[model samples]
Structures are given as C-alpha cells and as structure tokens.
Target: MSDDLTKAGCCAGTAREATDHPYEDRARGVPPADAVTQADLRTRLTEIPGGIFEMGTRKSTYPDDLDSPVRKVKLDPFLISPTTVTNAEYARFVEATGYRTVAEAEGWSVVFHLLLPDAAAHPHHPPGLPWWRRVEGAFWAAPEGPGSHWRDRADHPVTQVAWYDALAYCTWAGLRLPTEAEWERAARGGLARKKFPWGNRLEPEGRHAMNVWQGDFPRHNTADDGFVGTAPVDAYQSNGYGLYNTTGNVWEWVADRYGPRPAPGRLPERNPTGPCDGLQRIQRGGSFLCHVSYCDRYHVHSRTRNDPDSSTSNAGLRVAADL
Candidate 1:
C-alpha cells in the first residue's frame, strides 16, 4: 500500500489485522439491517463497549475554554457510524424524504471568516472577524457560498444539517443520534484520558495526522494539512475503535440536549444523558474550520452546542444503534 494511504490509515495491509477492533467487524461493509436503502448510501455501524473515562480536560490543558470541566462518565455498549454522514448519504435522505435542511429552509447559513470574498460586504459580520459572511444561498448543497455545489464534496461530511435533519436521517436508517456520553466514549476509542483520539501528542512526528486548518488563524490557511476546506471522509486515520473523523472534518450532532455539567460531585457514574429540556443539542468533533489560533476543539472530549434549529456549513452528524 502507498505511504500516504498507510499514514491516512487506509492501507489496511498488516495494520488491518494488527489494529482492527472487533466492534468494527459487525458492520465493515454492510449497511445496518434496517438502514434505509439508497443507491449511493453506504453505512457501517461499529459496536462500542462502554466503560469509565475522564470526560473533560484539566485547567492546564486548555485554560481559556472553561466549558470543558473534567468529570467521570460511563457509557453502555452501542453501535456508531464508522464515518461521518457524507453528502451523498444525506442527499439520499433528502431525495427520499424531500426534507429541506435548516440552511435551505432558513435561506442562509454561517460561513467561516476566511471563506468570504469581501470582508467589508456584511457590516454585521462579527466585529473584528470579518471572514464570517452571512452569504445568501449558502446551504448544504452550496457550502462555499452561493454557486458552490456538492459535486466536489460528495464524500465529504454533509454540513448545514440541523439537529432535526440529523435525527430524520437517523430515523430513516433505523438508527438514532448518539447520546453525548455514547459519542464521547466512542470517540475515546478505549484510550483513557488523552488529548486526542491517538494520544496526547497532537502530531506525533510533526506531521498532520488529522484534517485541520494550518498556518495563521482566520486570515491564512496553508492547506499543509492536505486540505484547505473539507477533506474526504476517509482522508485521515481512524481511531483505536476503527471510527474515522471522530475529531475533525465537521462537528457532529449528538442526541442529548445541552446543559451545564452536573456539579462535579453530583454527576452520574452510569450512562448519563444531558438535561431533559434544553434549547440546544450537543455537537462533538470540531470542524475543518478549527484552527489552533481560533478553535482547537478537535480533541476527543471537546464539545460544543447549538440551538436545535440552527445549522451551519461546518456542522453535520453520525448515527448510532442501541444493540
């Protein structure tokens, strides 16, 4: 196999036998038994054994991001998508249900600051950050502003999907969005407390192992990490559990509602879901827009939340099963 493929964990030569996780065996190339059938959709459900793990970072890890408070979390065995939902897969869902994504229905979505052409066009653009433009016609089909289409991003994670949209696709596939606990546990991939899925080292050998922004913050993206925008679904190495893009590419929506962590001492020790009624849902795995200078939420335990009705070009989802 080629070195790039091996580095990307796509070689699957001797590494397949040596590093393959048994959970991945359940749905290697087969769609879930009850998954919706579509010509272009491919589904892989991986089984994740649950256990206890630290759910947040130490103050020293990321001093500024106070949202991540270290806590112990436990999960139950569940099945999750081997990869993020791709544009092609989501297209299948839209074709079948005629579902209009939030971005499409809302008539606009948030694009990164660097993606816009003229920084001065939108006066309301985040104060100092003029790169994020509220471009009209910017939806899932057209991620890079109005005229941009999904042809080149067919294998890329389908962004601009709202919580409802993700839930719809999950239901159509006879699966469900993963609970926050399930999402984090699977992301950890059996590796206890570590900065990323692979380990504490962001780039073990000074090489970009995952798809993330490189170079200066919002002004410049060198694409040294192999892609300036979204990369292919399999563009990066899988975690210990054989799951791909768990930390980067796009933010994934989970099933649980958003709420403050239970006062550290009062948190649950077993399968804990978020609050009963909340306005926003949990989103995991930062997106391609993540940069060290701006947002470095690509870590395994890192998380963010958004209103259920909100959708952006950098948000997407993965499905999970109870069995």
Candidate 2:
C-alpha cells in the first residue's frame, strides 16, 4: 500500500487495495440469511460516553502495512459488551436454531498445530503460515476436533465462528456489530489513543495483562499469561468503560467491510465507517496466536480482515448491542 493509505488507517493487519490478500475470496459461512428473533438476549454491557479521541496509532512496534494513521474522531454515546460472547451463550443459540456454522458445513477449519492433542491433518495450510492446519470436523462445538468441546472453556469466548455466523448471532440476540470507529473507541476504554486498551505500557510493571503469546511465535509458547488457549471471557481488569480483553484473546468481528481510511487532508471524522465497499470485513483486537515476534496485532487499535465465511480456532466474536 502507498504511504497515503497507510497514514489513513491503523492496525497489525492490513488490506491493501490491490494486494492478493487471502481474505479477498468469497466467504464460506453457511448460516441462514434470515435473522432469528425469539428470546430476549441480554449481556453485561458497558456504557461508553461520547468523546473525541485519536482512532489509530501514531507509532507502533509492529509493521502496519501503512495502516496506523493516527486520526481524530468523534463518537456518540453507545453501549458495548464488556466481554465476548461465551461458549455457553453460543450453545444456547445453536440449541435454539440448530445452527450449522460455516465450519460445520465445510467440514474443516484451520486449527493451530500446537492446540491439537495429536497430529491430525489433511495438509492445506495458509501460504507462508504452515502452523495453521486444516482439521476436519473443527467447528465451534469441536474446537480441537471430535474430542474437544466448550465444556471446559464454557466461560471463554466462542471461537471457530465466521463473520457471518457472528452477525447471525447478533441478529438473534437483538444486537449488532460495532462499526470500526466505534470498536476502536470502545477498545480505548476512555483513554486517548494508545498502543493498548489499558495504556501505553504493554505490561504495567512487568505482568502479562491479557492473553497473548508470551514466548516465540508458531513454536515455543511459554503461556506465561496462565493460558494455552482462550481464557475466560472476563479474565482481566475492566477498562475505563468496564470492558475486558479488547486487545487479546480473539479477534472480534465488526460491522464494516474492509477498506482504506479516508485519505490525508480529509475532514476530521464523525462516526467514520471506512470506505464505501470492499472484499473483506473488519476484525478488531488480536488473538491468542499473536506475538510481537510475529503478529503484533495484540495492540488495541490494530485491525485485520478475513473472509466473512472463514472461521479459525483463534478467531472469535465480541457482540455489541443498540442501547
């Protein structure tokens, strides 16, 4: 991407205009298009006040593909769930609708190699990233394979859910995905634009604040954060607005399609929603697989994209509702 576009956006993941990014392909999710309406779905939500703040990072330790342009933005008051949707919550939806996620329909999803109890593979991994293994029958219900379920991690955020799957849940639960601007705003947790949700310092006085890769990437994971995979949805201290884990655990889906930020010299934004259209959708927050040595998107304000139909073990959902 050009310096102009890079200066217009922020995040560890970048969607170049002409780049052959994997996410550009058609989404593969199989959730029905119709939104479900039945139960009164409610969650522990944090009320965010209206304010002005920088939306992107001015500087980052990780390479940004020119997506870290710091820009001023204004937002209206809103309410956001403090934590992501948990497995127990998602199970309720499945039980109600007999929902078959994209992964279930596809019969396979990407699973991190280290998470598996033993070697099980068909060997279709992402180019340049071989640690991702395509395992059959890997869906939200069976995160690791037929043997794994959410019983142990019931309180943890649900994973192996595609963007379409998340929207379906939001519709059924009487919620909606937050826009990119709103996500960044809530992620800041009332702080001015900083590297992370908590503050500028990654570990305030040398303690792992959230679940992220503590050791090497794709190889040796010390798991010093007291987790080998997803942690409880409400693991750490709440942010200024009472939100948790805005920077780590799993990438949260947002409402907007992926596109470049407004070019330089544009007016300061008010509820900015990115470009008119694009191939991919926005994924805010980083995931368990992220590390400074490889993927440093663990920093708040960083953004990424994926096919709306694709699901992976590391990707999950954080729902938002209209208040």
For model 2, how does the per-residue alpha-carbon lDDT over 1-323 read when each residue is reduced to its tens digit?
Answer: 21111111222111113444232232222233233243234436677787777777776554433356688788888777888989998998788667777677667776787898765444655545567666778889889878898887999999988777887777566677788888888888878756787788989889888888888777778999998788998898878888889988988988888765765446667877777877677788888878877678877777777756667787777766556
Best by lDDT: 2
Q: What would the per-residue lDDT of candidate 1 be over residues 1-323, giving only the tens digit for each residue? A: 11110110000000111222222232222243333362123336888986667777765344433346677877777888888889998787667666666556556665665666654664333334445555667777887566678887899988777676777676566777888888888887788878788898888788777888788876788888888777888777888898888887888889887665665666546888778875666788877777777677888877777655556667789888886
- For all candidates in order, the CA lDDT equals 0.68, 0.72
Worst 10 residues of 2 by lDDT: 2-11
Pairs of residues at least 3 apart in sequence or in different chains that clash in candidate 2: 6-66, 9-67, 10-67, 11-302, 11-303, 28-309, 29-309
Candidate 1: worst-modelled 10 consecutive residues by lDDT? 5-14
- For candidate 2, the per-residue lDDT at 247 reads 86
RMSD of 1: 11.9
Q: Pick the candidate with the highest TM-score.
A: 2
